[model samples]
Target: MTEPSTMLAIDPAAPGGPEVLVPVERPVPTPEPGEVLVRVRAAGVNRPDVLQRMGLYPMPPNAPTIMGLEIAGEIVAVGQGVARPEVGDKVCALLAGGGYAQYAAVPAGQCLPIPQGLSFVEAASLPETYFTVWSNLFERAFATEGDTVLVHGGTSGIGVTAILLAKAFGLRVIVTCGSDEKCAAARALGADVAINYNAGDFAELAREANGGRGVDVVLDMVGGDYVPKNIALLADEGRHVSIAFQRGPRADLDLSQVMRKRLILSGSMLRPRTVAYKSALADSLVRDVWPLFAQGKLRAIIDSTFPLADAAEAHRRMEAGEHVGKIVLEVP
Candidate 1:
């Protein structure tokens, strides 16, 4: 079969809103060494994509300008040194960019076989949230079995994955969602307690739910005022990992509390990491987390899907904050 010279992809023409995500024909990217060219079937939309469209998260040096971070598809071609994912392999990969396209050239190290019993749409939803949650909650926070974790934005994609993974790993999970309905959804996903932030104080509720010892770990996306509160809710030697700052980046924290509690505060950005680093993360996921999917202990929670050209509408839905889980784009 002849490969197409050009493919349709969503590009942010300028820094602005969802309207900026325009479809246009672009040259197909050729995989470099240790990479594979994927015929994208589905892509996951994430909060960072929104920030990138708004010019808040500028493309890293040498990264593609396309908006998607994760994609599920088939390997159509491979670059030199790519051994495992040969042509015709079905995979879902975490990408630095360029996933919002008909095809994407991704580092083979970032690719993983689509889990058994999952569709391309569900596979697409896994990489970004799963990688982030795994890197932060388990790796950085060092959360282990029997630990209790408080996850903010419990109904969001990252939160849902964190809840499921934490529960699967034998940790007690508490969550905070914006509404009562979202709180209920979190509980159904295995959260031991779900705090409706609009109805109650999340820090207090988390502490109360954890026997007044506070949680052993916190996955916080909301910064600003949430920073101090998150710090307040951590038990001694607790870890706090920040992935995104939906509220605001700036925070005035009480260092005294951090010092007294011996808390660990850390965060990571996935896109800029070296391929070797991401490859290691992929290995960890396949070895430790993939089995959970086959056992029916882990699953993707999709809120909605849009056709490739209607990416702007998908972005609108994500920004509206009504969706409970991930928003996906189907590529033809």
Candidate 2:
């Protein structure tokens, strides 16, 4: 079947609030070399997408201005040298941009087969969070079996994925949520302990919950004041991986403590990375993470889903911070 000349997309014209995300007509993109044209079934909404909508996150050079980072769809066309994932193959892809549209041109190597028995929305939720946690928690922090990890935002997409990965890998996990309900939700999802961050000192609570040994790793998305507390919670030679700074970016650190504890502080931003680098991450996910999804050992925690035209409402839901997991947009 011939593709349409245009498709609906939520690309804001200017930096502003959720009200700016209005559906607009955009030309259907053709597959570039080493790429595939996917008829997007769904796209995942992330914190970065919120920031992008507000104009706080800058688009990488030559990237599509349309807003989205991950999408799940079916391959409709393939560019040169793309021997695998022929027409009609179902895939979920990580994109630097352009995922919010009905159609997306994705790098071939950045595409992963949708796991058996998973919907497009579930598959759509995997790329961004899975790639992030796998890269930082396991690859960068080298979190191995028997380690204890403290994950902030227990009910969030990243936090939930961390809990599941920790459980599947034999690690003890403690998570923090804003409310008792989310705490229970986290525990039900296999977290060893879930603390309500608003009730008391999360560092103390997490430590006590972990039997007072302190955590071997801390996966922090909240920066600023939490930085010192996070450092204090780390055991000797502990690793701290920062993925986002919702509170604020700048943090005060104690160099002496860092030196004495032999702690490592590191973080990474995914959007600005090269296609070759992200492709490598996709390969790693296929080897180490995709099987867990295929076997039903891991599942994406979907909080809510909206139609493609309701993209504005989806952003509002995310910004409200009440949702328990990923918010997805189903393409019409």
Backbone clashes, each candidate: 0, 0
Clashing pairs in 2: none
lDDT of 2 by residue, 144-200 (tens): 999999999988889989999989999999999999999999999999999999999
Candidate 1: the clashing residue pairs are none
TM-scores for all predictions:
0.98, 0.98
Q: Model 1 segments beyond 4 Å from truth? A: none
lDDT of 1 at 18: 88
Q: Could you give candidate 1's per-residue lDDT for residues 1-332 as a string of tens digits?
A: 66899999997768998888889999999999999999999999999999899999977788898779999999999999878888999999999999999999999999999999999999999999999999999999999999999998998999999999999999999999888899889998899999989877888877887888888998989988999999988889999999888889999989999999999999988888899999999999999999999999999999999999999999999999988889999999
The segments of candidate 2 whose C-alpha lies over 4 angstroms from its true place after superposition are none
Residues forming the 10-long window of minimal summed lDDT in candidate 1: 199-208
Per-candidate Cα lDDT values, in order, are: 0.93, 0.92
lDDT, candidate 1, residue 174?
A: 91
Indicate the residue-level lDDT of 36 in model 2: 99
